[model samples]
Target: MTRLRTLLVLLVLWCGVAASALAGPIYRVTVDTAALAGQGGYLDFLFLGLQDAAPATATLSNFTGALEGGGVTAGDASGSGAGRVILGNGSGWNEFAQHVGFGGLFGFDVTFEVGGAAGDSGTNLTLALLDDAFQYVGAAGDIVTFALLPGQADGVTTDGNFATVQAVPEPGSVALLALGLLGMAVLRRRSR
Candidate 1:
């Protein structure tokens, strides 16, 4: 091949490498039930406004909680393609439900990778909690809502409030994965 053509191909391949290197950080958000146990309220419904986040990119299904009750249902609302905004809004929210309330003792972790940095504030994760149909919880007798704000949902220490656990991929691991893919590509080409 001509030198110019080879250089162009190398440039294109380098671009792909850079793009693949820019993998987003994975996070696991748990709707903690430590404090909610025996609170006469069931955290059955969990919703998220992923406006700036990326839910569709999630490869794994929602993590089922260890609760004995109604059951669990999880899916990516962004797939509905109802509108431009995937984040929870008037368009809709990526909603997951345990059907049976955790009753404050059982909690599930939903791991996801944001399109932004591993822990960027721009990837704010707002959360909402709902009870069984028509069931009133708390003194307000209204649906309960909680955001995984800083210090609000610290899964590390379990503050008894909603907690978020960020699962950032190890750099060495990601590099290994990228290298594996590259090697596979080279092998396929050589065989051809």
Candidate 2:
């Protein structure tokens, strides 16, 4: 009986420890499109794992005009319709937080300069975080996604970037934990 009780206690403690250790933090994802142009095309922003603590902001670091090469469609049928523009070289920064029970939140702010001759010069930015499969993980896995609008503000902006707390357990780990608990229970019953 004493041995069974000890096993039970150990099982419970293990579960608690696993739960706490698997707990992830909250993240905020944002996208800014202040330097992009509508004529040159739009830009897509992607984020992996972002925390959702506070002060979620996405800052645009650099912007370069699209490239000109052969086999390029003059008017591509893309989402923006301003034609496809390849990014030269740019960098940006994003920040967020992580907490227990809460998934994460993220924000992004991007700026784009419209092409001077296109007459469709505006910024189009989008901020988002996606998993390995590119699936939108609003409140599940560790990914965030952001979308920016053209001709919009040139600074950081917040949107409906909130996710619920999700606690997903691994199949193997859960099975092991359950088996351990069940073993303790069975032992207790046999001893009694």
Candidate 3:
């Protein structure tokens, strides 16, 4: 009976530790496109790539994005590569006039998972607005390059240009800590 109890306690402790350590951090990246709304074209492409990132230290995965404000109507597509995410809207070959009439201040909300050591940091990604031909709009601030550091918020903005990196709070670690304490208490009581 004592051996069974000990094994059970050990199992609980291991589980608690595993749960807390295996979960990675989630970041919320927001991009505002208010500046290019009336620039004679609709927002066609939003690219999050590692073109200028520190590939050795930075890691990102599990991407999800959404369009906001009064500008998002119809026609949207998305895809992901090894370390990049591509979002598109409107017809191709149309140049930078996809949503010329649908011009309205809008923003993009992107959430992704990241993993890196405490000191691991740098520009991990860049957010770019491109035309149907995948050419960047010939305007300032159309390309916002930023980093998503652990436990820190980051942003780059210009002419309504904005990007915020916010970490999603996780309670698993706290719950695991509590579980560990409870297991320890029970084990002590049994020993006594």
TM-score for each candidate, following the candidate numbering? 0.41, 0.24, 0.42
Off by over 4 Å in 3: 1-10, 38-123, 133-160, 171-192
> Candidate 3's residue-wise lDDT over 1-192, tens digit each?
989987987897788778766665445554454555544433443323233322222223342233322232122223322223333212221111123322343333344344444445433334446554546664543544444554455544433344455566556777777887887888788789
Ranking by lDDT: 3, 1, 2
Candidate 1's residue-wise lDDT over 1-192, tens digit each? 667965775676666567655543444445555545554334433345445433222222334455444434343433211111122322233443334344443333333343433443322233344455635343232133333322223223322345444566645456657766876787689689
Instruction: Name the candidate, 1 or 3, with the larger TM-score value.
Output: 3
The RMSD of every model to the true structure, in order and in angstroms, is 9.2, 18.2, 8.8
Residue 36, model 1, lDDT: 53
lDDT of 2 by residue, 1-192 (tens): 987987777777677668644432222233232222232221224222112211122333322233222112122111111222232112232222111111222222232232222222223233333333444334233322332222332333333334221223535466667767887887789789
Error of 2 at 53 (Å): 8.5
Which candidate order results from sorting by TM-score in descending order? 3, 1, 2
